[model samples]
Target: MSSLRAYRQIVRRPSRKIYVGPVAVGGDAPISVQTMTNTLTTDVDGTLDQIRRSAAAGADIVRVSCPDEDSTKALKDIVAGSPVPIVADIHFHYRRAIEAAEAGAACLRINPGNIGSEDRVREVIKAAKDYGCSMRIGVNAGSLERDLLEQYGEPCPDAMVESARRHMRILEDNDFTNFKISVKASDVFLAVAAYQALADACDYPLHLGITEAGGLRGGTVKSSVGLGMLLWSGIGDTIRVSLSADPVEEVRVGYEILKSLDLRHRGVRVVSCPSCARQGFDVVKTVATLEERLAHIEEPISLSVIGCIVNGPGEARETDVGLTGGGGGSHMVYLAGNQDHKIGTEAMVDHLVALVEKKAAVLAAERAAARAAADEPK
Candidate 1:
């Protein structure tokens, strides 16, 4: 049997805390969720729309590529309009990094070593400092330094860590330390190993990800397995689930990964069983419909939807709201783990939605009152 203690608690790694805008990452701060925009940076409105939706979906930070002058020029507006902190993605251009900083970016995602001469590197670092921006040293296995590739003969964990250290040295040598690092790879094994090695190598915040992790479904699984291993080990601080799907999906999946480990809680968490022959209701369709209906809820809630009494009541007893298939076209509804009432199959979805919304309102009011009490001149 799996150890319940292991599932309930994780001893996170000790690391220096840093800020991506006002959002704290690493050390004792809550693990942050991040995603990147797929829209063109020049399309400020479109990018801001995506960013707004992502923030609404629970993205604490968002990255947008700055490949040219126009993107950096547009960065001014994007930064002004974004609901969450923006990290300018500067793959290789030192100038772009500087521009992004001046444009009010909260962070700049770049490898300092790749920014050319020490003087040029200092310029970008200076810009970051002047603009009150942090930085991210992103090292990908597919883009390892040629020298390291020749030295290690492959993109192994050691190679990736070495690459990170090289870039880290540039920042540290310049007396810059407000930064996090990521050693990502497309392969799960490679990404996990590199992250593990890097985690122990430095006290810098680790930005976890499986870079280029395929489509929505495939990427979610690959990232879950890869990120899950690291997060379970308490190695990640801020995370972005790289997916070829919509950026909002990335935020959603990132939250799901974090939610699975109980690292962070946001939105409704549905617990459903796969439909079996004994089922009296359409378990699959019901669960999906409820998920969409409850997507707007940001408050944490546990809901179970099982097809029959076999395991339904058992699961229902642990959730905030639950539904179990019953006889004569009526199904059981559980509220706060108690048998509340029954509903017909035709009206089940709407009824559950109403119950969840009401529960959410109650929780929100309770939270507000607590916050108000805490601020009562204590």
Candidate 2:
């Protein structure tokens, strides 16, 4: 009922905008979510399958590794069939970078210096420009340039930023600016510090990540902490939660972080409580089930699944759909923030799923109508 305060807002950093296929990054664009495919690049069908699933999970961009000649050749089909833009990941292979560009990659994740020789760098850059592809200067703390490692004696924020600058200089020297940059480290502190320094040092869009972040659960927490701190400061332009899980989970986690920050919203935003002694239903299992069932609904909606009356009514007031557990093996359901009806536990999940589906359908029609209205001659 009240407007958000200034402190609740994220005033994003001003940086030059660039396009990865159709998605824009930086300079007033909605911060994008990216995930990398674990499938081998040469496995075209397998790679496309993963890309399709990741895109459905809300990945704005997907990167696939291109380690050799075979991978780049397979990239053409992968790019052609991909629903979202493809970023070809090239490390120490300028030829693969060029081939990826020629294969219709939307972006090349390549470091110019490591690709060997100024001429090779120029050729890769030429291919990128000629093929209408963008570039990403990816600097990972685990793989900082040898000279920088020697100079700094370790991987730290300074060394990371210096590596980014060195690569950034290569593109800048060639008068190329259609690119974004990332300085990632497995160490949260190092990654955050490096991103902070780089954010101040240049106006290039930053791709945030804690590289080599562990498995799903642990990696999610680690990335959330590091990325949350950076996003809270309005520093990152795009993010990838580098989890050692399905790339779809990475996209999901990326969106969750953005949703928590109020920077972006897609699909259901669940507000559930950890079960306690007074809970009326199985809160843990219910929330998990609801999340799995509602994953396909991309329309932004919020639902509150609380087990008892203590905080149930309060949370239900803020969400679109609310299920509050009550006695008599039945539960209370709230629609549009008002107490609406009751149903038995046997019918609860299905009933709530129907309510959300109906709500999402209505929301979709309203959006379509709004778009039609906007398109009409004024």
**Candidate that would win on lDDT:** 1
* TM-score of model 1 vs. true structure: 0.98
Clashes of 1: 0
Which run of 10 residues does model 2 get worst, by summed lDDT?
Answer: 1-10
Estimate the TM-score of every prediction: 0.98, 0.98
**In candidate 2, residue 130 scores what lDDT?**
97
Identify the runs in model 2 with alpha carbons over 4 angstroms from their true place: 1-4
Colliding residue pairs in candidate 2: none
Error of 1 at 65 (Å): 0.5
